[model samples]
Structures are given as C-alpha cells and as structure tokens.
Target: MTEAPATIMLNGKSRKIKQPCSATELLSELGWKPTQVVIEHNGQVIPRSETGAIMLREGDQVEIILPVAGG
Candidate 1:
C-alpha cells in the first residue's frame, strides 16, 4: 500500500508534501531558492545553512518570507 503524503501547515494553509522532506527540499518544491527567502519552522527562524539539515514532519508549521526590494 502507498503511504499517505505528509501534511504541513505552510503559511497558515494545509499543504501535502512527500515524506522525509527537508526545508531545502520544500523550498525546491515550491519553486523557491534558498537565498531568496527566509524560513520559519515551528515558530523558530531557521538559518539558511541549517535548512538542509532540518527535516519537515507532518503537522509542521512553516512560514516563508521573501525580502522586499522596495522601501
């Protein structure tokens, strides 16, 4: 039997993602680059260098913020 996809709370919305996904992988799946945004996992800000090491679990809360160019 196939395993159910993991569900995470992304930006306050429910999103289904593959199992064993890392923060970096999530970014890739969302068509985003690591350098282009900041990530907050479970209410904590995740450093860019640590994104690859952080694994995303079901019910995880993630917030992705992109830097604005305008003043």
Candidate 2:
C-alpha cells in the first residue's frame, strides 16, 4: 500500500492524505462544496475564496469542520 503524503488533524482524528493539496483540491477531490464546509488552518478560519489560493505544506494541520442539518 502506498503511504500518505500528508497528515492532518481532522476533528480530533488524524487524516492521511495522498499529498499536500490545497483546500480547494481536497474539497473537490472529496466531492465537497467549499461554500458548505468550514476550513481552518492552524486554528485560523479561512474563507472559501481563499481555498484555491492557499498552498498546503507537509505536516501542516488542516481542520475541516462543517455544520449538519439536524436539531
């Protein structure tokens, strides 16, 4: 099995991704909408418009937290 290229903490869980991809790349790859997901980098929240311009570094911590439709 191929090892992961990047490791990020997602909601207290460690996620190993294929590579250090931008938020836009990751979201599109996962079939998620940038507008619907909340993306945080190093505890700082970023807007959806920034996703495409932000470049990810190795060992960088990315948090993807989203809101659910439930009461």
Worst 10 residues of 2 by lDDT: 2-11
Candidate 1 per-residue lDDT, tens place, 1-71, comes to 66678999999999998888899999998899999999999999999999899999999999999878787
Q: In terms of TM-score, how similar is model 1 to the real structure?
A: 0.89
For model 1, the superposed segments whose C-alpha errors exceed 4 Å read 1-3
Tens digit of lDDT per residue, candidate 2, span 1-71?
A: 65458777756777766755778887787788898898888778888888887766666678877998898
Tell me which residue pairs clash in candidate 2. none
Off by over 4 Å in 2: 1-4
Give the per-residue Cα lDDT of candidate 2 at 40: 89
What TM-score, computed on C-alpha atoms, does each candidate reach?
0.89, 0.72
lDDT of each: 0.93, 0.77
Model 1: worst 10 consecutive residues (lDDT sum): 1-10
* lDDT at position 56, candidate 2: 64
